[model samples]
Target: MNFGDRVKEVHREILSTPHGDLPQEFVTEAVWRGEAAYFLGWAIQLFDKPHPSTFTDPGALTGVLQLLQPDANELVPSARLRAHPEIDDYSALCLLIRHLLQLQEMQAGGRDSLERAYQSRLAKLGLSPASNRLEPGAADAVISSTAKDSRGLYVVRSLAAEWLLGEEE
Candidate 1:
């Protein structure tokens, strides 16, 4: 399969499972809660999938976009996405990766621009970090799982960021 086709293939696989296939149970639970549907759609975007979704869900798109951030540099493509955009909407991936990076920033330190964007989206979702309902110390229960999975979430999100945000202008 081609790069885009590979991405779409994974997207279908990930979306097939209602609970997702994350490592930890909590992380899987969180993904099932919303992140899976959300992030899967994000992956589809990078694949250039047409008509991702129009559901009234909030975090759905953000999670996907967060994963889709094409977060790799010039060297490699993020696992979530096959190849970084060479043609259209470079900034689109950047914008998405920035959010995932914010999750890492929150995990590593505290607040920053990424956090601001995450907060904005969280606000739209009617969720809050203050809630502290999920695991991994952040409202985003998936973030910790992403960090936990070296070849899984962490690698994928990093790739998305590097591929998207770290790409040269």
Candidate 2:
């Protein structure tokens, strides 16, 4: 299915059930859809930044979905997109996703372990916690992250990256 059709279906599924009523697996898929939507929205300047969490900020996502012509296969027009993806933003988001994937690997880990692992990784790179620079492409970082999560958001972001970068080339 094309991006527009796929996202519209996901959006419909998301709205079909109320939050608390949806099954956990269903909710998880919806969260992934939200993440994908957020990425595309940010890419098109629909928002200034990706939503901080997978679950919050539905309004922004809803606005993005509403902009699509249902079942159109095509992405938002080029005129709506930024001249290009900001390398810093792309790298930072990818780094965060990579960190989350690593933390997710640890057995029965929680938020605390995530923070510790993040700091340790930062130290290893000689980067302070406040550092904005990130080393990019830790080898199939997108596939690795999406594979671990079983959610489609990372894949969507990767597709967005390819779509945008493909245009550049």
lDDT tens per residue, model 1, 77-141: 44444333421232232233336545654755555665675556444433343223333323243
Please name the candidate that would achieve the greatest lDDT relative to the true structure.
2
lDDT of 2: 0.53
Candidate 2 Cα misplacement greater than 4 A, ranges: 1-11, 51-54, 67-75, 85-88, 91-169
- Return the TM-score for candidate 2, rounded to 2 decimals: 0.47
**lDDT over C-alpha atoms for residue 100 of model 2:** 61
Over 9-126, each residue of candidate 2 has an lDDT whose tens digit, in order, gives: 6556666665567667677677666666676677677676552323336666655555454633344444276543263356345446655655566666476877886666444533
* Model 1 local distance difference test score: 0.38
Backbone clashes (count) for model 1: 17
